[model samples]
Target: MKNVIVRGYDIPAKTMVIANIWAIMRDPGFWKDPEVFWPERFEDSDLQYKGHDFHYIPFLSGRRICPGMNLALPDGMKPEDVASSEAIGLLFHLKTPLQLKATPVF
Candidate 1:
């Protein structure tokens, strides 16, 4: 890593650059009605969570991404079925506890 200029700003080497994912995801410039939970906005767009598109990075991007980044929904549940509630805290999280019932399959 070496010192480089980014967006006209000189960033020194080893300078930690933390991406404000929350703010970025909710930025009105990139998203319409960002504060509203509208999953359909991505239904027709080319946005991806693979970090290719900086606008949407749920599991993060690049080599440091989560191994289990590939995930699926439960058999009978739909995307809209999941309730979205933000808990009041420093970090982002759902206010309601997630309850899942697992059925063993042979």
Candidate 2:
């Protein structure tokens, strides 16, 4: 059901087409006044990123869909908020060395 033949040509199976998601979502052929930002576009509509609906595929669809996508997406908490639990594991490893001068109190 994935492959489709058109004009004696095959689109192939499991092909990675470099499609422009921005343009596709704004195309007038499929949507009316598509350039507008309408969150209600999918209101009561079957169009979804659950795989079959090719129009919108955010985390993708089918078995390859992102498993942790339903985390609800947050803006992230400050380091001070979770100081005990949070840890920096980045790759770039950019930091400035600090110098300290301390005196012991009696």
Candidate 3:
């Protein structure tokens, strides 16, 4: 997730590569007001979850993408079936936004 500025389409011999995804995701140079939740940051970006662009990798790419992507279940029984039936219940639920409080405690 390091920001390696390449002048040309080539990798330099002495380039520094950082492996901190969290820090890169919050870098102001790449993201405006990185602390805020702005989906618009990706509104006009060409990055995709499938490694089309090396910038963003919300879901890790390659053979180690995700277990769920390669998982197999019965036709009638989907993964959600096992998930809801288990202690975890539903992974996500949708609700309309009423009102948000911006305290800025930090």
Candidate 4:
């Protein structure tokens, strides 16, 4: 997320701040096997979607943190609000058994 804001009366030019969500998501220090999808990474942690932790900010940080939160009363439902609920719901409806097949060549 890249944002440009004009600051100072003398300098009307915009000041740009580039928020690197891709870099943050791929940081190996925070995410082991960063390229891989692993929900277990957050299993026993207190990290949240509010972006306070800095380790992860799927919903982003600061004043721009999701407008939908304002629509609903603050009952800690923002995480679900920004998540891919439709995709998850569709996956949940799969009746056939799903499987991943891989072979070790080594």
Candidate 5:
């Protein structure tokens, strides 16, 4: 019914659309200022990460669900230990400074 420009080329539009989730999530119709990283958006919302919500599907959904589901990683090391190790590793290996803020769970 219309022409959709893809990669600078005009393609004939059809009843169905084939688009990646990355593009769909950024669609203005679904989100306002989609380009901005607003973690607080989910702070007050009932948005889900367990594949039930469509607005935010971080781990994908259905057949393509993540294989690391229900994973319980070992906790032999403390949170600070892991954070320090990662920060130091990045500083040495990648020559980048890792910013980390420690906070109590309670």
Candidate 6:
């Protein structure tokens, strides 16, 4: 490993890199009304859901995409039926836990 420079900062060799995804996603400069739970902001976005863009990096992309990305709702549940309310703090929590029945698809 060798020294590297990023955006004018000199990073020592073999340094660990961590992305503050929460801050980046809520950056006012990159998003308008970022605190609001607005899904429509992406309606006109050209960015692919696969995290091709850094502005939004949900579970990353490509070979490093989250393993849980394949998780799906139980049968008979629509997206709109899911609760969207959130309680923000040091960590985000669902204002109300989602109520659902888990029925085996098999």
| Better structure of 4 and 6 per lDDT | 6
Clashes of 5: 0
Tens-digit per-residue lDDT, 25-44, candidate 6: 77888878878876566659
lDDT of each: 0.70, 0.57, 0.54, 0.56, 0.61, 0.73
The TM-scores of all predictions, comma-separated, are 0.51, 0.38, 0.35, 0.38, 0.39, 0.50
**For candidate 2, lDDT tens digit of each residue in 1-105?**
379786887888787668686677677888777767664566576755554767554445667676744433224544344323333576433243222334455
Model 4, 13-51: lDDT tens digits are 465556679888788787779888665566587866554
Worst 10 residues of 1 by lDDT: 51-60
Candidate 2 residues lying further than 4 Å off, grouped into runs, are 1-16, 57-106
Q: In lDDT terms, how accurate is model 2?
A: 0.57
Clashing pairs in 4: none
Pairs in clash, predicted candidate 6:
none
Q: Write the per-residue lDDT of candidate 3 for residues 9-64, one digit (tens) a residue.
A: 45556766567877777788886787886545665866564556756443456775
lDDT of 2 at 85: 36
Better of 3 and 4 by lDDT: 4
Q: Model 1 over residues 8-62: C-alpha lDDT tens digits?
A: 9999999999877888877788778878866556557676666467655544568
lDDT of 6: 0.73
lDDT of 5 by residue, 1-106 (tens): 8878878977886746666898876788887888887645765877666747876654468878766544433445443443433334434542333434444658
Error of 3 at 7 (Å): 13
Ranking by TM-score: 1, 6, 5, 4, 2, 3
Flag regions of model 3 displaced more than 4 Å: 1-18, 58-106
**What CA root-mean-square deviation does each model show from the true structure?**
8.0, 14.4, 14.5, 15.4, 10.3, 7.8
Clash totals for all models, in order? Answer: 0, 0, 0, 0, 0, 0
